[model samples]
Target chain A: MGEQLRKTPYHDLHVRNGGKMVPFAGWSMPVQFRNGILHEHRKVRGSAGVFDVSHMGRIYFRGPGAVAFVNYLITNNLERIGRGRLLYGALCNHDGGIIDDVTVYHLGDEILMVVNAANADAVWKWASELKPGDVEMVDATSDLAQIALQGPQAESCLAAPFDAAVKDVGYYGYAHVSWEGAQILISRNGYTGEDGFEIYVPTQLAVPLWETLFRWGSAAQLEPVGLGARDSLRMEVNYALYGNELNTDVSPLEAGLRWVVKLKKGDFVGREALLAQKKAGLRRTLVGFEVAGKRLPRHGHPIRSGAEEIGVVTSGGYCPSLDRGMGMGFVPPELAEIGTPLAIDARGALLEAKVVERPFYRKGSVKR
Target chain B: MEFPERLRYTKEHEWVRVEGDEVVFGITDFAQDQLGDIVYIELPEPGASLQRMDAFGSVEAVKTVTDLYAPVSCEVVAVNEALTDDPARVNNSPYGDGWMVRAKLGDAAQLDELLSAEAYQKLVAELGG
Candidate 1:
């Protein structure tokens, strides 16, 4: 608490735009603007919204062993995706507990790993100790600034500013675009579950790029969003947040991220433990539930079934787009079935909730 | 943010008003501004008794929750039902239609303990409002 919080390149811009700043993952970041989180959330779902994602750590890997090294580090099969594409996976310890969930971007000669800001140092330390002689690592977090332009109008919002055919970027695919002497990487991906683009720009060009996007996107109703809306937007789609759904105490399999784990692709850091856990069967699994009332179910709230205290809430809050209270939590497999009735202890009040499908909102345009 | 000159206030950021035999209160504009957009509110039912400084209700913003403290000892006579469907009133009209609870005034001396608008504004300024 005595240490000074890190600030992103857009810190001044955010403050000038009426952003309500808060401490998040060691960074002084905006939780919402004057329009508030609800407006920003709906803007992303209906039109477009831009977010400063520079706080997330970006590490670039190169050399002949880059591909092999990343494959060994993550649970996903890198062979499944070719150059210009990215895959979501988790980095786990030998005990199969997740260290952090990351998105690995394959760029042919170089590979980029985007990690959670809170676990950046831990992840870098873990990778550094396991680095091969032929592999090279570059922590480009401070050197670059990232922005995510998202929603139904994302393509139109981004098309006019860059040289590349922004609409042609496939989901999870990226393209290198040159803009006014600046080299930028635009990836057609986002955490909001909307059709969007994540742009990685040089730190020096970050402010200009952000202003340019807004100036060009003004016609498309693009607004600046913050972490408050960002959290709710991802929770609506049942995305697993690192510290909440995944942590040193939780396994990827138990977190309902099995699709990213390719055990058949040969050896990985947590392969043996994952295999052992698979054989033993999971005792608890992550499930999404919707509360019957308006009370926002918060993290660490106790989950009760009849008279027994079963589990605890990981990510829970009011989903502004859905206009309801929903959340994700880990519970016994039998209790995770859809339609299972549950209650969350919010303070002394019990909020009624029921287990539902994986995603609380299924109308996202990410795959469109 | 508007602070009504007629109302008294507490350090917790709640504004108080004495209306004939009843007293009305709500979170101050500064409190609402600090809380960002309010999403939900939970207040005690009518006839619920509360002591001075007791938590009688709660206000829920998108990212956080804050307890609403009582300004003085009283019996809750009525709660603002409008907030049940539109909690944003706390952010939009904290001093007007957004009032939280109406109660029969208790221990008139407690009213003297509440800060006047001038004094409340000073408190807010000291808190870096």
Candidate 2:
């Protein structure tokens, strides 16, 4: 606990707002705020909320071969997503296992790839090693601060201060605009399954921008949310987290992410292994399930068919939106079908659960 | 934040209030504060026997679950029914309305193994501080 954990630019600000700091990855970050996770989660769904996402690794890919290098390193079809588009995909190992789930922003001149905080260093090193001589990779994490402003009223809350014209930004689209006289990037996509924006700004202006947004959005009930609700919001929408659903031990195919893998678009890392696995057929697949009772399933909790431990939960918790327990787990292909019943041996108590469809929380205002 | 002076405490952050031959126990305020909002609690059924320092229940927070340990040997006499529908009470009124179980003491002398109010305060200062 005494280890000197890295602190973001907004670390002290979070503490001032009653954030309960916890060690996440290599940084001391807020897990929850004064209002607790349930309140913060619902607030984001109803009005607006802000989250400090500066902990994620931000890398810049520039030069002639940037797009080709990115296309070769990750599974997403970059050719289909033009400039100013945000693409979500994963970098995989040679064995077809997920190295890290990443989000790439096509900035036209330079490609900006955002990776998980824990996997940033390793992924950067991996990318730097394999990069062609024509491409240049630069780590810009220390110079930038990223904030996710989310919810239905999220845009209107800050429409005036940061610019009100962002309402026209399409889903997965971003705009590089002048904010408070300085240039910054604002993406329409958010992790909460809500209509919001992810803004990137210089590190020195982080606090000023935060204060301005909060001051302007206070009328709209803009709360400073922590990572606790950020996790639940993403999980409810079936977004795969790097450590939970996507890891080196799990393949994208097995994790229900086959749509992103571009087999027909040419060669990439892990392409051969994924091809072989496709032909071999999948033995296990990730499935979402709804628990029958209040006994919530947790990560590593065993999933059972009667007495046999068939699989384990990757992410599980109370879905405050549904007012019920929800979970995601890996089960045999036979048990992966919708409506198939299973049991979660949470700690020791057995709770009945059934396989459900993706995006467990369907009322998200993502399109709105 | 405030530990009651009348109750005996465990290093695990459990408070025991001795009443007649029955001893009622619940997690201390410090424990509940540390746990954040308690979402669920699994308590041992009434009439269950527990040895000193044995785990009889657990409380789940948003991110973690903490097993509740018995401070002394006892027979479960009463279980809190309110907590099933409203686990947040443990965070609201951790000492009073949040009391988890009532048990008949196996040996009243086992209370000696617990830290006194003063001793528990010092322990918390040294540990959580």
Candidate 3:
């Protein structure tokens, strides 16, 4: 396979623990463990699970004008965010299309932006061009590694290695903790829509911290999960993925993420286009659909109304928790209402479906 | 992977067993493991005619969809309707209840082209599964 690509700190450990390895985002990552996807996914929903997210990109912007430069690039209002707080926002292009959905952290004078691994280079280049005189943009992706501890028992599991104060870290808020003489950034945010902590540390020190957490949190029923479970977990909560749900051709407003776009926060990239589109009304909108039968619609499947094809499915899979097939796709704005009957043409056969609310399953520990 | 010694195998990972002139077909354990959790299976009609190595149907797992190929030249005689409601049977019992179809053999000579269990096991091992 193309030299097998780069590996994370737990690569060897994953293989030893019966993990099925697959190439994802140019990295050799685990797809599933010995317990399988269903067991691992339910484990995270009921208890806690650790994930190796080292492939995610970490970019740092420093200097005096870092805040101003970032404000001009992203669609969210950074002035409202305080230090140690995380903001879920989107980086859009000049045409109002989403470049990438990211989490921005205000780290005092500097800003730390976490992006999807597959869109790292694209986001870096886009942000680099916006860097003016004072701001210095550095791609700190290779210098750092990230791990996520997610589920209902996440807080107690993380409290062992860190401090009891880690429990008080509010949702979307983060704190810098000193573990094994290394300063790691721990944020109470995750894509699984569960109460979790995404910890960022130096690349070399990742293995030690992983081992410590796995060893100490073993009693808490924390299993080392892989990407297969991760995808199902996020899909269960209807979280958007980079290539599947969001892309350069789809705008944040069209994807139902208008809450992240702050039009009143002065001028920013894609602001005018978004404002104009908001005034004119959106032509197409993304909606969640549940397959009415046993047949599951796949990505690139044609969505139809009667016999006329209208849209295409962007992401689809069988939701284990929901015990049905679920997917996200962009249909005509008139047909975007909840409970709208739709059909997905799976090859030559038509599978009955209905457009429901965003999340297909909602019994997660996200707010807890 | 568990390759039953009495079963015949295809290069595409389909397994078949001949009972009189009728043959039962399903994916092997190696195929099921590689596909992850199977969510759906689209089977052909009972009266459909199949050619050797032709697409008979498809199996949908969580992240992938694999096209099922006919193991031998035969006329489809029966389809396992149990898979319509419970596709997970493919993961639970790939060789038994998960059998996709039963077909009456048109050419018995086509059965000899399939791999023996020992040969199939060696092929799976060589493929790094």
Candidate 4:
């Protein structure tokens, strides 16, 4: 497994700091550190936590046709976004099926797409096929490393490193700042539902930057987080994961990402199919439910409405914050209503569950 | 990782201590350390019958879950109700307050098949615990 798995630039640092390296999306990533997922999670919620997200793919689109090509490929309307703003949307196939969920950063002249690690190569290949000759596509995944500083103290922790006014970067906004004479990109957004910054730096500076953040943010109790805590954090906020919620088989509408789908905006990939899907109505929709029992509903677990198996759990686990077994899964429209009673068949035992409003842990300081 | 000398062990990483006709059991320290920050635990109720090597309960950590196997056939006399409210006890005290179940021993001969502290340590070492 180690031979096939790819390591990030901070691999040595992760191992030295007791990050339990595990196989994830063809990359060997730290699932959790020596402090454990619970500790790391509380650190992010209470103070600050840093994540080495270099494993995610960064594809840059440049040249004359860059904006037009990106506008046509993604479901969200890019014309609404200005330079230095970030947009979250999905790349859908012509049939309205989600190809991959992406976070597109409008960095003035170039567009940087941060895609999931599992779908990096696949996304690149898919885009390359549709890429126009005028647009130059460059996969900068190996050239640069990304770090996420999350929590309420994220601004202060990140601000200590640079003289630039990082606090000015509003939610879903970004700015280029210089640290140690090297220019780096800092985006005020994250998946943890915290006030955070996603830093993009050159590969060679990854280690020094990681060390500097810890040194600067030690007073705020910032620690290195891993994928395990990352998953739990996102689940708490009901954020959709790549294979879990948004997949090739599911449409973005059914995955509860209708906000990103701009039907009024000009035609784009999956526009027709999505319009057709809208006319036909969604057969199954994603719903958040909490298990009443101690046992958690895991992925692929059967979800039942009375005695009949209605749907399958797309993502399920014990939310450390909520202190309950909660998860999101696809169920029929009739059963997707909040307050609807449901059940998760955990092996032979049927745990009582109920559909509830998303973001199982709500008190996130995402905007503030 | 404490492997108590008086306790008997299984390859699945459960430990049992025999006292007269009854036995007390729980997961080993190494097992808890590997599982990391247990959030929930599912255990059989009192009076539940168990067979040797049968899954009597399960430990749910944040990332994954594992079944706790019964070391010997017995009737569950009581369960550690404290774990329901505070599951982290298993991580904080795997050998002490984290004890899962108290049961009446069905066969005294099954104890011979269990590994001693020294032998269990070797097994843990082989598994890179």
Maximum-TM-score candidate: 1
- Candidate 1 at B108: error in angstroms? 0.7
Better of 1 and 3 by lDDT: 1
Q: lDDT tens string, model 3, A262-304?
A: 9999999999999999999998998999987767878899999
Pairs with backbone N, CA or C atoms under 3 Å apart (clashes), candidate 4: none
The sequence of per-residue lDDT tens digits that candidate 2 reaches over residues B7-80 is: 99999999999999999999998898788878899899999999998989889787678899998999999999
lDDT of 4 by residue, A1-368 (tens): 33688899999899999998888998999999998999999899999899999999999999988988998999998889979799999999999999999999997788999999999988899899999999999999999999999998888886665645687898999999887878899999899999999999999888998898899897897889999999999999999998999898999999999999999999899999999999999999999999987888888889999999999988899887887889999999999989999999987789899999987888887894
For model 2 the local lDDT of residue A18 reads 95
Clashes, model 3? 0
- In model 1, the clashing pairs are none
Please rank every candidate by DockQ, starting with the best: 4, 1, 3, 2
Model 2, A130-210: lDDT tens per residue?
A: 999999998999999999999999878767765645767788898887877788889998899998989899998889988
Stretches off by above 4 angstroms in model 4 are none
In model 2, the Cα lDDT at residue A356 comes to 98
Worst 10 residues of 4 chain A by lDDT: A158-167
Candidate 4 vs. truth: CA RMSD?
1.6
Q: Is candidate 2 or candidate 3 better by DockQ?
A: 3
Interface Cα RMSD in Å, per prediction? 1.0, 1.3, 1.4, 0.8
Q: Write the per-residue lDDT of candidate 1 for residues A56-87, one digit (tens) a residue.
A: 99999999999999999999999889898998
